[model samples]
Structures are given as structure tokens and as C-alpha cells.
Target: MTPLLNYIVSHTKLPEVSIKNTVELLNEDCTIPFISRYRKERTGNLDEVQIGDIVKFKEQFETLEKRKAAILKALEEQDALTSELKQKIEATQDLTTLEDLYLPFKKSRKTKAETARQNGLEPLAKIIMSQNVNDVESVAYKYVKGEIKSVEDALEGARHIISEWINELTDIRNNIRQQLERFAMISTKVVKAKADDENAQKFRDYFEWEEALSRIPSHRLLAILRAESEGFIKVKIEIDDEKALTKIEDRIMRSNNDCTEQIQIAIQDAYKRLLLPSLSNEALQNAKTKADEAAISVFAKNLKQLLLGSPLGEKRVLAIDPGFRTGCKVVCLDAQGGLLYNETIYPHPPKSDTIGAMKKISSLTEAYQIEAIAIGNGTASRETEAVIRKIHFKNDIQVFVVSEAGASIYSASKIARDEFPNYDVTVRGSVSIGRRLQDPLAELVKIDAKSIGVGQYQHDVDQTKLKKELDVVVESCVNAVGVNLNTASTSLLSYVSGIGPKLAENIVAYRDENGAFTSRNEVKKVPRLGGKAFEQGAAFLRIKEAKNPLDDSAVHPESYAIVEKMAKDLGKHVTDLIGNKDQLQNIDLKKYCTETVGLPTLQDIINELEKPGLDIREQAKVFTFNQNIKTINDLREGQLLPGIVNNITNFGCFVDVGIKESGLIHVSNLSDSFVKDVNEHVSLHQQVIVKVLDVDVPRKRIQLKLHK
Candidate 1:
């Protein structure tokens, strides 16, 4: 435990005391959101990301420790566990180094080295490796036994054993790794049979590509690997063979003699047949792991942004799932996103019921008292939006074109089915569109993060890692913007601190079976919701019109006594102190500070007091696209048009410019200067104006430069 604590502290550069307290909290079954939010003073006010770093390092340490234990046990079983070896294995910090240290002791299958040892040539191999044997042939003649034909045969077998020894030498392997780290090149070539295949055309850029393995961008590397996986290309890692061999020989060779010459042969054979292949693969796997991390990081960031996207709040919304031939499916949702009505209207082409659609929309807006309209940006979305805009409704209603990216997935999901059991998929999809506008976090949590569609090679990256990262991001975002206890769905509640799927279900079930919770204390009455769960999740759950106003704020229930004390000191009621900025500013935070409740927690309490139950997310705004550009063919070079950044990657961002084909804002065209990060320039759902650089109608590609 101490070693693990020290490792996390060293790697994260966090204060040892803070890391120790955090680890204690984690071991006590505390979640990251709980430790970072509720126990700030204990963790030295570490933010979510910082606490996340601690968690990552802790998991890695546990993995390393587990591997070390297994290696020690394996060596013990083989009667090869030396004290020095055990100490070295236990001291290693990473899996790669530990595995390398354990390589020699690993049991092997039948190989040339094993065969030679079985044939009694290991002593001869060692004598030659010592480089002191002047007459190698005389030494080899002694080993001319069963299956040993001649002196050359004996020497060859000895060389084979020497090669295996060279492969096992830790220093030799590490030296080659250092060389490969600096000089390895990854190259890809089109498979001979797949050279002219139409499906291989997508990877034409990588058909004959070579780049420094260390310098390649993660997205590009993922693409190359994907192409290789699909049998479109052959990939290889290479380094200067002469330089690597020379370095190994420099480590092994001592003198110029017959024995030295024989050792040289073994060195070359070991490098080509064993070392290069094994180490090169290790190097590539390392690179791939790094690439996977990078890709997953981008996906997680994009998912966070998409999940925390600005909400339209509790407004009566009319949403449409646009289609041309099938007609647009429209649904009216009440303020809380309850489906009031659903029907289809065809306002374009075949059905062309423009006046009828407009009348129905106007009547629905007035009937449901709709404040906003959400249109899914799918087929015929623009045409439907145009028709809706033509109607002069009794009330002013803002219209939004929402990304239909995961709407279908959500509509067909079991959660959606349970929520709207009587409705078909189209009606459920329209409801999803409207609810997404009302609250992205609540709606998106029900759908899989990957299906949200903001990613770079999401399927190609590590699935477990991507899922873990995305879950963390979702949890962070959900906790960051607190959940409404009375209104939050099971999906939203599930992400709050200690409340997982089963607990979320229990909370919802308790809410339905009994009634909405009136205060924080009532939460404990829910079956199976114990002390720890309440401590971790109570603050993140908000209840409007609660008996205690603090129950609606971010303040934890445990801090109610402190607030009551503060109000008592101020000679006012707790309700009077709530949102009393003048009184809050006058209180000396130092006076309230205790061993457990320090300035950080006190300050947070004061901040929450100022804005009780206020959402951190921005209110959704209406955005409009260029009216002139309906398709890629209508776009012209140098025409500036409004766009929304739908997806962000390391290389660039994709912008939806009111067309079927989204435009590419390449990293170079993002700005006049070098763009290190695409997110620094743009984020998911950011509205920007872009100038069209090129539009390839046949290929359905649009290139745009950021107008800003």
C-alpha cells in the first residue's frame, strides 16, 4: 500500500498527504466524484481530473503488483526464485519492464536452444560465449555424439544456444529497445492482391506509406492499423539493422578469436531470428497503446462536451424526426418532455402538404403552448424547418436543428421502450429529439456514448478503455451539473456519485411507489440506500420546493448543521441566510473552518448558497444555417456560410454546413498559424462561420476554412 501510494504521488506530482487521504477514501468505497467534491480539504482540493489521475495510477500500480506476485509464484514453482530476482521484480514500476525481467525464467516450448541443451551442447555454447576457447573445433569434437554429425554441426548447435542466451540478456534487449525507440520506422504497402480492389481505395493514402513510428499522429496510426486489419495493407516496423546489430555485438564481443567469430554468428542470428521480431512487435504494441489512449482521450472529451451540451430547460417543445419519402414524424412534448401528441407530415416532394403541415404545426404550438421546436438534422430537415418557419404562430417559438446522431439508437433501446412502451420507434425518436433539446445530459445518458458519434476511429480503439473513459466523463459531467431528484431519470441518477444502476432503479422505484422526496433526510428511507450512498450522492441530487432550501442546493446534508450555526451566528433564520449575498460576504470563512471543514468546503458552501439549484450549463440558443445553401452542389468556393462543429478529432473538425456532406476544417486551415489542438480552436456543437474552399459533388466532399 505504501509503495502504491508513493508511486501515485511520484507520477502525479500531487502532495503525498493528499494522495494518501484520497487512497483512503477510495478504499473506503468512495467514488471519484465524492472524494473530489465532498472531501476537498482531505484531498487538498484536488479537481476531478487530478483525482482521476490518482485513480489511473492506483489501478496501474495494482496491475503491476498483481503481475509481480504471479511472476514470483511462477519462479518459486520452478525453483528459480532468488532473493535478488524477487526484489528486482517487486521494484519494477511498469508491466513492460517487469515482463522483460521475467523473460528468462518463462517456460519455453521446444526450440533450437532447448534441443541443443537436451543434446548436451549448452556447456560448449557457454565456453564459446566466454570467448576464451582458442580451438573451437577441438571443443566441438568432444560434443560429437547422437545426432551431432560433424564439428560444424556441433558449432551450429552451440551457436543456436548462444543466440537464445543473447535473446534472454536483459541489457541486450534494453539496448535494442532504446535504438528502436529513436530510429524505428513504420511502413505500410498495399497487399499485392488488394492493390486494385475498390474497397481498398479508401486507404489509398496509406497504400505505400512510411513514417517515423515515434512521430506518427494517433489518428493516422489507427487508420493504418485498421487498413492492415481489413487486409488492405501490410504493415512493418523497421530500424537500421546494421546499427542495432553493432550495438548488440559491442555489448557481447570481447576479443578477436575463433570463439568471438562464433559468438558473432550467434549475435546476428539472434538479432534477425529472435530479437528484432520480438522487440519490434513490442515497440509497435506500445505505440498502438499510446495511440489508443490518445484516441480515447479525444473521444472522451467530445463525449463530455456533447453530454453537457446547453439545455433548453423545461420548455414545451415540438420535435420532428425529418424524412422525405417516409414523411417527417412530429411529436409535441410538454414542459417535462412528456409526449402529448405524435403524427407525420410530408411537406416536401411526393406528399407536398406544405399548407396542411404549417397549419398543423401552428395549431400544435398553440395547443401544447410550445416554446421551442427541435428538428432532427436528418433527411429533409432543412425543408421541414423552412416550412415550419413560414407559419405565423400565436406565440414566438424558437426552432433548433438538433443532431440526429444516436436518436435512432435511443429510440430502439430498451430504456426508451420502457419509457414509451405504447409508442412506436418513430414517435420515441421524435420524443428523444425534443428531450435532448430540453436536457442533453439526461437524454444522452440513456444512449451509449459511442453511438453519440463524436469520435475518431472509436470502434478501432480499445473498447474497454474507451468505455471506462467515457463513463468517467459522463459521471463527471452529470455530477458537475447536479441532478434533479424529483425529475431526473434513472439514467441521470445512475451517474450521480455512489448511485449505480441498481441504486438508480431503486431510487426511481421508491419515488414511484411512495412519492417525491421532500428533503435530504427522506432519501435515507429508500430501501437499501444506506449511509455511504447518501453521503456520496445527496449533495448532487437536487429537489425543488423542498422543506429545507439547502436540499435544493449543492450543499451536502451533513453541512446543514454548519449552515444553521452560521445563520444562528448572523441572528437570522437558515432561509434568510440562503442567497443573502451581503450576509454571506460578511461571514469570515476562517471562523467556519474546522479540521474537517476548511476554507475550500466553506467557500464551496457559500458559492452554492449564492446560486441554489442553479444549473451550470448554458441555456440553449437558436442557430440558423445559410438559407441559400441546401446541398453541396449549391455551395461555391469562397462562400462564407454558418456551420456547427459536429465532430472534433486530433487532426481536424467536421462542420455541418446545411448540406448532406459535412465540411472538413483541416488542422492547417483551422487558423493561419500551427494548430496544436483542434479543440483549442473548436469544440463539439460550436457554431462557426466557414468559407468553402472546395466542394467535390461527385465524391461528396466539402473543404472549408474557419472564417474567424
Candidate 2:
């Protein structure tokens, strides 16, 4: 194992046996789902993320080992593989250092030294490098034969040979590169194009600036680099050559001799011709990579917050994806998120028919017995809600403004199109918006998480890394909220601990062939789902109406006997004792407290038994926007407006005030008193009451005050 991988395993407190078994399984080409399912006892139940980390670490280690072997072999072939050199190669941890050590021995393009050797000038070049010049011009004149015609020509040719030799000295090049890299400043400048040029305005603001490379933020650096590459700007890194030259010269000209001047000239030539371009390019590339890593980390963090946003729980809901001229698309979904009906309504004029729109919504609600309305917070949403509020119904129906950030992307996606072939794009989007309110996790997996736009610099980051991180987030969320065995879609089940696409499909196929799973043991009957697969996955697969109540909770099957023993000792039938709160409260929990059954587990069991099939989501709260308000113009100063916190960033919080656009409660305006972290005060999906502070109609910006 690599030291880095070893360190991670140790620090993460993952069991050594589990890590070893997982690594072996991964090495043998076992997929994460396969290994996690079929090798539960070997892996000690390590989830996909942990297994993935091990796989990545193992691959990196093997790659580094291969590189080390190649470097050693290349050095040996060049007859420069000294004992010290071999040790250095073996001991090096970083790829850069290993490459630096092997650089001089590695083959290069045809150079002056190789050409001079062919022309029989190597002997003279060597004598000059010894720095014991007898007579410089006389020594050069002796080589003035065939290719070396003139005395000046001979000296210049000899100088070229010596210069190539100096360049070959990796130590001298390394010294020069270090000095230049430290003192260099990257400067980017943009020039104005002709007034009529099509792309002039896009780059006008970045006309001139110089920044320390280390201090520049990743986003700004990437922006500047991209602009320069697009021909909108010019960029360069200016290095202090005099200082760099001094460092190089000092190393090469250690002892002052007759050939010191020649050596100095040779060193300077090497820097200008061979070293500067290569070193500068490398440094810039490294900077760009670092910037990308930083940006990707930020994006992953933001995506996590958005994905983990609290769900409103399962309820019958009416969803509306709003529009202006095209009107509003409405969808009605049952409590289980199955679509019941859909239609379009024009609540805003040009095409506005308020009475007809109201009637359509009322008819759908009455027919479906809808409990709530989940309106997409997109274009014309407020106008649509206004129509819904005006119509009175027998049941008290709540209204919620659901974030539709990626709803359009999902609607236009192949999955959505396939799921609802008969429906229009807008209607599909409304169905997605409604399903999100019922279960965010199930609906979100259909769209690319990056397109959801909850994260920062998501587009400008490393796409591969971002996808991996977001996939892990999805897996974690799915496992955290155990999957419903009978009802989960393949997309949802695919994220379960031990289930992949194939296994999920098999489960569905078995269900379709037979019927729903009545107990946890029924999962084993699925094709290719053996004993081990059942062990890893059964605990996380919830059965709402299983014969045994424990199957509905997170407690694994292995622990069922212990719980049954406890119930037997308590002088009650297992079912009666499980949910009997008075009996549970009176039983001394200490009697059940073993090494495995600690206070935490005991308490969890008690809670689970009391609320069998308990979902962690909060009960859906019913809220409605006032019909009197539709736009910023109708929002008066100091009037309290009920809003939902759509996004919380370090700078401020954004609240959706039952409008097409959301208003900002800037960090400074978030409260009557000082506030630091916005997350502490508000979270994603939280409901708040804020007063309108300022409005800019032309800019469509609304400032809000949370103090009220």
C-alpha cells in the first residue's frame, strides 16, 4: 500500500481487514455494487464511498510504482545509475522529484552537444569544462578544420558545444527554474477592439492588471486564462532573468578558471534557449490545475448542501411550472408520487383566462383530493398562485414554492421524456417539481447534480471529480434514508448500499414476475441475490408491512434474535412489547446493554419500535401566499412577507417571496443585530418572514429585511 493510502485508512478508522479485502476485490475487477453485495463478511459492510477510495488509492500506488521502475531502468540504460541515484529514486515520494532526478539521463531532441560529438569537438568541449584554459584562441584554432573553418567559427562552435553540455546538467537547470518560479508575476491585459467589433464589450473590463500568481483566486485566474485563450486578452509571466542567471552561474562556475567566461556564456545561452520556455509552461499549467482543484472543492460543498436539503415528506400535491405567454403547466400527483392528471392554464393575460384557469385547478384538486399545491418558483409563478388563492375549496390546501433549478433540464432529459412520452416538456417539468416535494432524493437522481445549480463554480471545475463526489453524496443520502423495497424505482434502488443497475433491475423483474416483497427474506429469492447480498442490503431495505416489525427499521436481521430474547425476558409477546410505550418506558434498558447493545442502540430500537416505518423527514407544513401580492410593486416597505429561504451563502440569504424572482436578504440586512455565518441563522428550505426594504424594477432586484 502507498503511504498516503495507508494514512487515509488509519485516520478514517476503517478496519484494516476490510480495506485489504476491498482492495483485493477491486484488484480482481469486482464492481463496487458487486463487491458490496456479495462480499459483506469480507468487507465488514464498508459502503461504496470507502471502497471507491481504496480503489483510487490502490491505482495511484500502482501507477507510482510503475513510474519508479521505469525511471530506474532508464537511468541504468544511460550508465548513470549510481548507488546514490538509485536510492534517491527509491526514496522519492513525489512524481516531480523522481522526474527531476531522471531528467538528465532521459533521451532528448538532437542538440549541439550530440552534433559536436559527431563532428569530433567533444574532447575540446570537455577540456574547456575542466576550466584550465591554456590559450583560449590557440586551443580553438587547433579544431579549425573540416566543419570548423574560421578561428571565430571554431570558437563559436566550441562555445555551442559547451553550452549544450551546461544545459544537460540537470542541477544547473533546476536552480534556475526555482529562482524564476519564485520571483515571477503573471500579467494579463486586454485591449479594446474597434467600436463595431462584435465581441469588444465582453472583454472591455479586463483591459489591464498584474497579480501575484499565488494570491490570485482560482475563479479569476481561470477567467483571465480563458479570456486570453479566446483572443480577447494577452497574458504573460514576467521573470527577473538577471537574478535567475546569477543563481545558475554561481552553481556552474564554482571555481574561477580560464574557461569561467566561456562557461558563463554557455549557461546564459542554455537558460534562454532550452530552460525558460519549458519551465514557464510547466509552472503555469500547475497553477491552472491547482485553481481547478480549488474550484471543484467549492462546487462539491455547495452541491452537498442542496442535495441534503430537507424534504417536505410524501403528500398529495398540485405542481405548477409557470410561464408567461405559454401559460402555466399544472400536474396532480398522489401521496405516493404517482401522477394522476395534468393540464395547462393561462392566469396572466395576452392569453390570460383567470376564470378558466381557476376552474381547471379546482376541478383537479376536487377530483384528486389534493392536500397541497407545490408551485415551481420560475416565470409567472406568482401570477399562477394568485389565481389558485382566489378559488375557495372545502379542504384547507397549503401552497409551497418549490425550487425548479434543474426541473427544465430534467424535463428535457431522456429519462423524463421516456417516463412521460405523451406529456409536453412543461407538463413533465411540473410533474418533476411536484415529485421533488414528495421525495427530493428519488426525483433528483434523474438529473445531473451539477446542472442543479446549488453549487459554486460548478461549470468551471473538474467534471470527472465533481461527478464522483456528487455520486457519493447521492449514495450517502439514499442509504441514510433507507429505500422502500416494494415501491422504490430502479434509479432509487440503484443507490442502495449493495444494489447496482443490474441487481436493481433483477429486483424489479422478480417483483413484476411475482408480487411485492412481504418480508426481508424475500429479497434472496431475486436472481443472483445470494446470502451475502441479503446480509449487506436487507438492513437498509425497509418493508412497510412485513410480518416482523423489525424489518421496517434499520436494525439488521442478525440482531433480531437478541431483540426477541429481550422481549421474551420482559414477559410480553415481541409485537406487543415493541410498540407498547408504557412497557418500554418501565423496562430497565440497562438489562439489554451489552457490548453490542449499548445505550445508543437500545434507545434507537425503542424509538424504531414505537414508530415502525418511521421516515426521518419532517411532517409537511401547509403554507399559502396572500393573493393581494403578485410582484415587487405590490410589496410595500415594512410589510411582513412570508418567504422560503431558497439559498444561503456567506454573503447573504435569498428568499422566494411567492414571485417569479427571489429577493436577497444581504448579510448586513439579515437581522437587527450582527450576524456572522448565514447558515447558522438560516438553512436551505427554511421558511422565514421578511419585510421589503428596497426594490429595483428595471434590474429586477429586491432587497429584504429579516428583522421584522
* Cα lDDT listed for each candidate: 0.91, 0.75
Top-scoring candidate (lDDT): 1
Q: Which stretches of candidate 1 lie over 4 Å from their true place?
A: 147-152
- Model 1 RMSD in Å is 1.6
Q: Which lDDT tens digits does candidate 2 get at residues 553-607?
A: 8777876876797788887777887677888777677887665445655665676
Model 1 lDDT tens row, 1-708: 489888997899899999999899999999998888889989989988999999999999898888899999999999999999988988898888898888877747588888888889999998998889889999999999898888998999999999998999889899989988998999998898988998888889999999999999999999999999999999999999998989998898989888888998999999999999999999999899999999999999899889879999999999999988898899999888888999998888798888888988888888888999999998898888889889888878899999889999999999999999999999999999999999999999999999999999999988999899999999999999998898889999999998899999999999999888898788898889999999999999989898889999999888999999999998999899888899899998888888799988999999989878888888898999998889888999989999999999998999999877899999999999998888889989999999999988877888899998
Query: In each prediction, how many residue pairs overlap at the backbone (N, C-alpha, C within less than 3 A)?
Result: 0, 0
